[model samples]
Target: MFDQLIAYLDSVRARDPAPRSRWEILLYPGVWALGFHRLAHWLFDGELYFLARFVNHLSRWLTAIDIHPGAKIGRNLFIDHGFTVIGETAEIGDNVTIYQCVTLGGTNPTNGVGGKRHPTLKDNVIIGSGAQIIGPIVVGERARVGANAVVTDDVPEGATMIGLKARSTLVPAETWLREFIPYGTPCDEPCEQGNGGVERVEALERELAELRAEVAALKEERQVPARSRKTGAAS
Candidate 1:
């Protein structure tokens, strides 16, 4: 427990810009949430379900973060800000960072039987603020989910997931880690640009329009046939 607490503090200090003092880390909601989570998880595993849920409720009330005791989280998990929701069956790996208003929610509402409804975040995954990862998707290691992105499918390892459909920016995980970008922005690309398929279709349509205009101009500027010119001259 002491080792895990140290790792957690280290992660928070590394990521956040404020509160440089060790004492200040106590005030961080991320710390409180995870600290309580440890106890809650312990109780849950011991079959003390009621006590686990009660602890979870208390943590939520104090931290404004909702993490089900059933969610298995690893060391050095940093939940930046409050208002984060981690559902039951959501498994989080080590060194994962999640910003405020992020939801690891279920895609299927009617499936109340509750299998693995929430998503799994692999090690070193960073989910930006306001991002929603739905269903039992696996967010691969070192993947970045952009702010406001709605991810309904699995994300490839080392990819940057962005846009409404969660298209990858193709920036590798190493590059993303090296450069800390806000709002999960691409290291050097615009966020709102169309995806590969959309861009390809747009480019093809532009080229086709240009080709059609060229064909029409060539037909209009074509010279009269030699035979027709001679016949007209004879007439």
Candidate 2:
């Protein structure tokens, strides 16, 4: 009973939603989330459509957190910051940690009757800020996804995923975290923009787009205007 209580407390603490507030709002968010998770999980199992969506709508309204009712989350699933998103097909094991802005989505077509999207995280996995783990990949147990890493592939157990497309390597969480600055910027090369990789990638992507636009403009100007076929003149 004590173990169960401790597990529940851990679960609540892990998903604390209040930030920039004093002690008052600190623990309340987690309690609310616990109640919400319970409701959402129940709805998922029972496939109660209207009630599930209603509860999810209310939960998102009250909490910035948005977790699809179809997602199966195990015990001690803490969500810090509340901007975290878990897809409908997402399967979360026990003792998972999801920070703010973490996205577990599916790249599969989001068209009519959306296909199976969203990644599954096994037990004791920690997903950092802005990390995107998409597709039908499986993140192994005790895996730590670095802040802002974009992961689209399967992750092995006890691995640390970092950088664009998320490279898995054997590294300690403390060591990897130490390489990131306090403002969430990564100390590494490609991940230098935000304590994580996505920021840097976004920067690079913006620069590439600008360069492409410039090249296109130059090419357009170098070419002559459309020629009048009858007059044989370039206008």
Tell me each candidate's RMSD, in Å, in order.
7.6, 11.3
Top lDDT prediction, candidate number: 1
Residues 125-173, candidate 1: write the lDDT tens digits: 8899999999999999978899999999899987888889789887655
What TM-score, over all chains together, does every model reach? 0.75, 0.64
For model 1, the superposed segments whose C-alpha errors exceed 4 Å read 1-3, 109-112, 172-174, 177-183, 187-235
Least accurate 10 contiguous residues by lDDT in model 2 = 179-188
Q: Model 2, residue 111: what's the lDDT?
A: 66
Per-model clash counts, in order, read 0, 8
- Backbone clashes in model 2, listed as residue pairs: 14-78, 15-79, 106-118, 184-194, 184-195, 185-194, 185-195, 186-195
lDDT of each: 0.86, 0.72
Candidate 1 residue 231 Cα shift, in angstroms, is 37
| Alpha-carbon deviation at 94 in model 1, angstroms | 0.5
